[model samples]
Target chain A: MRKRDLSQFFKDKRVILLIILILASVISISTIGIQEGLDLKGGSLLQLQLEKPVDQDTMNVVTTVLDKRLNIYGVKDVKVRASGDQIVIVEMAGVTPEEIERLIGSPGKFEARIGNESAEPALTGSDITNVDMYEITGTSWTVPFKVSPSGAQHFAEAAEGKGGEKVYMYLDGKLIDENPPTLSPELANGKGATELTVTGGANTVEEAEAQAMAVYTVLKTGTLPVKLTVIGSNTISAELGEQFLNGAIIAGLLAILVISLIIFIRYRRPILVIPIIITSVSEVLIVMGIASIIHWNIDLSAIAGLIAAVGTGVDDQIIITDEVLGKNTDNTKRRKTRTRMSVKNALFIIFASAGTLIAAMLPLAYVGFARGSSGIGTISGFAFTTIIGVLVGIFITRPAFAKFLEIFIK
Target chain B: MLEKFMESYKLLIIIPMIVVILSVGLIAFNGLNEGIELKGGSIATIKLNEPIPSPVLENQLKTALNVDEVDILNNNGNDVTLEIGTEVNPASFASALSGKGQVISYNSIGPVLSDEALGQVYWAMLFAFIFMSITVFIIFREIVPSIAIILAAASDIIIAIGGMSLFNIPLSIASVGAILMLIGYSVDTDILLTTRVLRRREGKVVDRAKEAMKTGLTMSITAIASMVVLYAVTVIFIPQASTLSNIAAVLIFGLLADILTTWFMNLGMIRWYMEWRT
Candidate 1:
């Protein structure tokens, strides 16, 4: 052969040696399981964009409060972190959607009042409603509601003799302010509208409006001093989760069976299928087991990654099959050497491709840390498990592929 | 014999043309759907305290958000995924949900994130290209032959992306990953052809091309068979066509095109390059 016709990289049968390395890598990876994420295991992915651009201080306070609340729901593997601008992400394993709603719902409001005086309250704002606002004077307002009929009559009789005495308004039973005495008003048909006026407090229109809404919501829910609006809510049915889990298991098992058949048919030998099955199963199992050990929550995305890995493993096996068959071709003397060369080249491509994909997924998995992007933890888990599978494909499974190929072809 | 051989090579150029035409036509007629990731939108979660009647909250989400294009999915009984349309603004989305039920959490990915994603996609493609060029040169070590193979791979990628763009399969991060995968697959096939030809000495360049073509064609068909089956199952299992599915479609197309080009067009070019140099 002319000097120019020779491959620079092919000197000293380097390709054959590289094949051995590839086989070693695959075998090594087979012993280790890749880590899975929350998506694969089934968890909640919650994205919370702030209502307003709150400074870091408020966010810290909210985070602490939310963390405690999430922990209250038995979410031990919970991740609460900040995203870009004014968003927060929370991931918890085995979290039902209902639990998420409760955690993210608005804190409660509490208010209390008694005749001309009041006690502190412990009810939420949702219980309150029917707030009527009346203009008392220029730039002044009075708002009140007939406190749920029972409290109304009780306060009415309490004020019957206490006319000209100051009446106080309380939220969650805490005195908001006490209004100075007004003229004794005539009771219509011996009944009166239970009312209170913010005589000289509240400072601005916004404050007055807020106080009235809070008071109304509290009275409505009949519970507390806070008004809550669910910014985001999702409920995953246990039935659906179970179905998904079943589907994943079925799909996985079917894939294994199909791949095994493929190996047996192509190689025309049962022995060739053994290592492929072992390597494939080991890759997935080890990944899932490690994920459980790490307490990573698996979700839907992680399932997708798992399936993708399954397909990739089969593809790798096909390459091994080609090398094995190529090794035993026309020139038996060069079979070992050529088999090694083919495996090396194939592994090189697999490594490069897997590396590129891992790099891409890593940033996306972490994207949840930035505000706006959701599914951070779930994406991370999927990526993590995927990279693990690819690593095994390169390190353990592929090397084992070479060894197995060597055995079967011989 | 020579005429028969020339006829074999002609099919390579013809097949890719047919694929390009079909891909273009399909993408043109049936527009692609854009996911919320690329376009701005709101995805809200609704939690039912108890197992409510007709547990799927799609209706409630529509009523709460007052939008009909909402995707209300049953999550693991306590939660429903409410993927509302892009028509709703982030502030209004919060307000609308707040008006009805308490919002548990709401996420809005801005137009900027999509832009950044787009920028990142471009960067990835660029990196893949530069890396592929260097890797191909290093691995194959023949300038003209390496360039020929790279050109075929590049053509497959461009045509795939173009097909995706024309089809309006909203470019996504996941799709980018798929395109990279297609690249590796296409290049591998090309290298296989080059390897068989480079190692052959019993025949002319065209003869080697035909010999490689037989094996390359078989590999491509087998791979496509598996991919088609997988894609079918994926479609049936995941009715919602996500980015991953879109990538699968691209891969199938690119792989099919690659087989045609590598088994013939690439072979012709490499043969020509070798003959001219000598």
Candidate 2:
């Protein structure tokens, strides 16, 4: 066998694709940045399940109210995301799960009073039938809402002879609107109106819209449309997360070193170990880059997925080395054309194996997404990362490795 | 000699089957423990500042929390993971620690959620296995060979579960995830052997099978080596991440089972199917 020069290797499409993807991954990794998952960064993640699914509008109210409540409670750096139509995932750092549970466990409370000195509330959150936010009017934004018949009656009684008095709005017993809408004379004449508006003026249209949205959120957040059950919760302390991250790094390096040793032993060629290790590492880097591009959290489960993927990547390389180079070792019987034939065959095996692995992972990923960042979060991340890893191997890295093995032939 | 090995293929095939049966029996006789993830309770990982024996920490926690049931999932030196029968808030659980250690992580699942987790695990594994079976059939397109591959994968999982039961590895989402991975990964050797023997025309069937064996054995060995190392490192450095160690352990067992199943059972079946076809 004669040595094939480097130019042909660079000219190969497979090698070129691999290099381009690796570069793209590096660029994306630098620009977009890979965000650490909650598991690694040490945060509390709560999966709140609604008793029943609600419309998107209701889901919005659920998230917005949760965000407002946490902020009002002086909780900083909180993120509330709605998953599907029913689940709400709330994540925050430096806050205990117990504190978050205590905060969101109860429904948001809204109270209306004609005066701050009054003891009893004239209206509660349940009194509001609907809050409409789609309509906006000029620099002054007005939020229209319908009140229950009973609520209209209580409001009329509370506002009777209280014209020009400011109606105070409170959410969870904290003052929301310091300068509230004043009770109109007509409404103060002891007649109840089911229709009402929380109107305010702002210097900018954006401010006006924001003001209306705030009031709407306060009112709608008054009571959840459906009961929320804390289905699952986990809290990882910051230092522990740091330790886990470090542990993962160490474990990964050791695994690679040991795997390389195995490859070297099996092939009995130190040079082959270099390419195998490079291809394997390239698979991981590409997976992480894709994860970064997609904003996937590189969590503990995901790291496991990376390992599984890299493990499979090594397996594929082994297959290629054996089929392409092993048959070549029996040089007297097999020809160059035969070696080329098995190379294609080796790739077929890679594709078939990768196909089945991805097939197996689909359901796990689906279930994880269905569970929405809860206890199954670990499993789901494992599934998703494994899928991505296998894909990168079959599509990019394996082909390059196969192409590189060509130089060993002829 | 190759012909003699072929004549005794039945015995070779029976080996993996008997292993699978015993694995089934082992799993049944020694039921795998349900992980806290499935039944709904609380598990707190504590990084103990000082070394404490398992019993001493267990007693202190039981008395401090006044909970009758407490199981230490993992206790590796200063890193200890404890599972409580019921949900305990972080405050009381922290105070129960009595300054011995700091809680690294805490996970709590109510009873209802545990039930949900179990249900999800069932469906996910079921569908994954089904999809994998379908993929294998689609790849091979032959009934007997496809069945052989599927059977090998099933046996691998059963044997792996048996290993889990024997080793006291609980059936949790994490461990179950490892089992599902076995379906995808351990089936590769079966795919290679079946494809080479049934689909390729380069050499004699025995020679093709032998060739495939070389490639397949290397694949399995490399995969197994990586898992062994991963399991070792995980157990040593980060005992708190028992999830990883559990996954690595399950994979190692499954891959070992796969070597026997794929090489003996699957290979024998494929060989018989190939001879019968002619």
Candidate 3:
């Protein structure tokens, strides 16, 4: 603790990286202002624009379908109403863009009619088993989908005796394909076809792929109604959100104080403890920076993820400290070599632990990605933040911590 | 050095095993409640204009909404969390609570996306286990030490879930996140112990274990301290967020469970394995 060699510390790449990141994070935070999620912000709002202006009746149908779809996802307290003939406004609290966008983004309604524009779709989306990935050729696209046997039966009955009549594909009452191929002569008498492709031609390959993707998405989501594209989405937090955030902040600060006290007690030296705390704090700040840069809302689950990441960061710090000082405090001629060996060993444990932590976190992140990371920024947000925090710890902060110990612990 | 008692310490592995068995039983019999996040429902908080007991409020809500099922998730003096059933109409809800209380907030959560999400939860758990096992195996490159570490981690999670079931902490997204955090902490201490006890030969096995314990316990207590503060803060300051409360509570349990799993269960096995190997 005697010497203050500032230049060497600055020269260390680990310290340099840590300092740069912490500075960047501070800038990112002040500029972007850490994105508070629904739990902190209260609730969110989403605006959906219908493909075309429809009747009040059609709008009602659209709103009702959207409401019921959210209900299916077990979300209640959602107000799905039409802003106008063309706009449907959905207001809710504690949900994410990913959750709602995945739920209501695509109008799940898919219908096939043999004779043409009719309320009675011979086959509904439920009839389809799965929507295969789109296949693109030049400026044409086809989304192949297979139907259940019963769906095939229903299709046969609809297409019966309609020889040479073109069958139309409709998604949310809009024509998926205009000038569709006429019924095959073999199928003209009502031969059953389980597999069907919604073929579309566009001026450009991108357009064709986009058209095919729209079909694929709608088919995959079970069903959606009245093609509504998300135009705007945001949420406001409840007063409870503010209260919860304050509580979390207070609790977090108190926790940090407790952790610092423990670290101070363990090392019994401000020189060692200060850097440990600073390293962890910087790690968290950098994580918050990355999160803000990516605009990951800081929700309850996300907070949990942050804690999980930082928790391991502290654990690794303890491991490094113990290993570096363990059984080799004597001033042997081999002190530097032993310290290097200890740092290397500590790095091994840090990397191994980081690997498993990330591995454990990946599933929750994957689930959050798949679905259920709804309201108040649930599952996946936690994993996302946790993964980011761990990566920051291992790559940036952990090495800096070791470098700090290497410099002064002798 | 406590070496005399250390011989019998190898038997301590069964303590966590028995705890795990009992935890499994508790979970099986009680069954973990999947929070409304997965099960279709909504949470509404009403700020009381007048002082009302939680049960009284629940009764009023049941009659007002004409729904027989209403749960009082939390009662934080003025802010009472009303765990009302799904499909709530604000108009009716307002009318239902007109004079009784003011509507602070209402969130009606329906069921999660689908069965696929539920399936994904299981898959996620499986993958976490598989990956953790692989990582431990790679680290130790020894089957027994690696498997023991993974088993301890698994047991910590199972016991934590059992603690949840026992304590009525519902399995929600928030609590699941807590469990995930616990998984990391559990593996952390185990890894610390295993690495120090098995890989490092500078000190006697028991001396190395005691040293690892000192470091591991410090890590655990620091974590536990935070969770305690968090839980206390959530309960006292922001009781309306029952979901937030779940995260803190579950994390506390998982961390506490990790201590036992790591120090006793995993440590005993490692010591025994070391002795048996010798």
Query: lDDT: which candidate is best?
Result: 2
Per-residue C-alpha lDDT of model 3 across residues A171-227, encoded as one tens digit per residue = 766787776767666665677889887878888988786577656665765654356
lDDT of 2 at B98: 82
Between candidates 1 and 2, the DockQ winner: 2
Best by DockQ: 2
Give the CAPRI class of candidate 2.
medium
Candidate 3's C-alpha runs over 4 A off are: A2-4, A45-238, A372-377, B112-116
What is the Cα-based lDDT of residue A331 in candidate 1?
65
Candidate 2 residue spans exceeding 4 A from truth:
A1-4, A72-76, A110-120, A123-223, A329-336, B1-3, B48-53, B63-66, B76-78, B98-100
Per-candidate TM equals 0.62, 0.84, 0.74
DockQ of 1: 0.17
Better of 1 and 3 by DockQ: 3
What tens digits encode model 2's per-residue C-alpha lDDT throughout A1-410?
A: 33345778888898999999999999999999998888788988887888888999999988987888677555667889887787788988888876657457656576778855464787778899987763577877667888999999998898889899888776666665555788789989888889887666677888676556656665655666666878667889888788788988988898889888888787788878999999988898899899999899888888988998898888888888888875564553556667777789998988998999999999999999877777665688999999989998998898888878866544
What pairs collide in candidate 2? Answer: none
In angstroms, the error of model 1 at B75 is 17
